[model samples]
Target: MSTNTVAGVRPAAEPTASQGAAAAFRGAVAAEWTKLFSVPSTWWTMLAGLVVMAASALQLAIYAANDNTNDDPLDDRGIVTVGSVVIDSVELTQYAVLALGLLAITAEFTSGTIRTTLQCTPARGRVLLAKAVVAGAVTFALGLLLGGVGALVARPTLGGWGSAPAAGTIGDIVAVATYLALVGVLALGLGAALRSAVLTITVLFAILMIVPLSLMEPDIAVLNRIADVFPGVAGGHFMAGDTEPYPGAVGLLLLAGWAGAALLLGRAALRRRDA
Candidate 1:
């Protein structure tokens, strides 16, 4: 079978079905990228997140400056964890990305833009995956910038304090970028599944914030154990570099599991439901 014939004939095997499908998937990704940035809200959300990061770093610096009693070795521990301040800013950054992820799909549904989206990309799974990819990429970049600038701005806060964060701690801080991206993907999945901005955002916030609070209030042995492994708690270890029950890898895997499960549920919802 000749792929290219010289005898004025259409190519017998120009591309396989899988190749066509791959091309369609790529097109969906491109469409999602365009749609994501085309809206003004996306830029505003990212800018607000950066502002939060900067303000948070500055706030921590002010607090450190106010601590005028640290002329001892043991006391330096108080300021050496300045990196923790960077991690704190992740909360605001994560929330911003989560909103971006949720709105990426839910806004489409709310404004009835989803119908047009479905018309263009009939494969619902591709649409969802594309949204996830776009959301993940944007958040990863945002998180890196946030983490870097956060550390730089807070470095002065740790001046004349304990030794600098070691290489491993630096790696963990960098891992915060991946953690943020995963959080965004998780929100994107929830958005796809719920298709309502208010409900989706509420549920996400509850999962990330309220559920742990409720679980901790009981203080039961089993409940406390469960709370320790909750996505938010486990995920924090990634950036905070806290190693009590497990290492950073465990934190990353736990958070990644959260994101994977959400995306699967979202895909199922998109496939089973009508737009």
Candidate 2:
């Protein structure tokens, strides 16, 4: 027998701490993904969003097509912007997107499954990050679907209205998808911290819709500035490629900042509080 060998075999090396942590995080993400897709409400909410977007697209397209005051549809200086029609449909359907994100985490808490999740993962931050990853991804896809469907449904009527440049239309669709992805992560963060579906949904709705609408007046410079920073308004500016208040890129950064802040808040709560 060789001195360096024992029974012609060697013991396996133990995994490093980093490798162990990585494995745990990956497992957590897989669990979160399974939980999200397995729910019936997830499909229903997404379907509702699709229906709303299609309906809104039809309505907006019809209205745009009926406008005969414009001397030239190609000039489109006074006519409705085709990009706006796509964005408007997305706006009408975004609630379902938010609901999908919120439910991912809140449902776990509501059903007492979060405790089980935490027990399995042990590291709360990993669990929350996993939820964020899964929610953000699914909602990003939802955004793309909604945006594409809306554009296709409206293009037949509004295709000539305004400039309807292919580049601009494509940009708007991408922006819509990006915005919805950030909004989904934001909702997931809020859900993790609040742990109540109803309350989180209500608060998120107010932040995205009610507050922005209430501050819509441009007369007040202060209010206008505040409104411009809200995720909903910022997302609108991004999708429309508006330069007012800030460039579309800046608007995207602002929305991303909001999502980052929410995730940080959720991380703190998850680490400090018991599941």
CA lDDT of every candidate? 0.81, 0.85
In the range 1-275, model 2's lDDT, one tens digit per residue, is 76766999866778999999889888989999898889899999999989998999889888777674467766444456566788987777888899988898888878888888888988888888998999889999888888888887887876556446788777788788898999999998888789898999899989998998888755688888998999888988888788998998999999999899999998998898877
Once fitted onto the true fold, the runs of candidate 1 whose alpha carbons sit more than 4 angstroms away are 1-4, 7-12, 65-77, 162-170
**Best of the candidates, lDDT:** 2
Measured over all alpha carbons after superposition, the RMSD of each candidate to the real structure, in angstroms, is 2.9, 2.8
TM-score of every model versus the real structure: 0.88, 0.89
Q: Alpha carbon lDDT of residue 37, candidate 1?
A: 91
Candidate 1 lDDT over 94-160, as tens digits, reads 7876888899999998899999999999989898988999899988888888877877787776576
Model 2 clashes, total count = 0
Task: Output the TM-score of candidate 2.
Answer: 0.89
lDDT of 1: 0.81
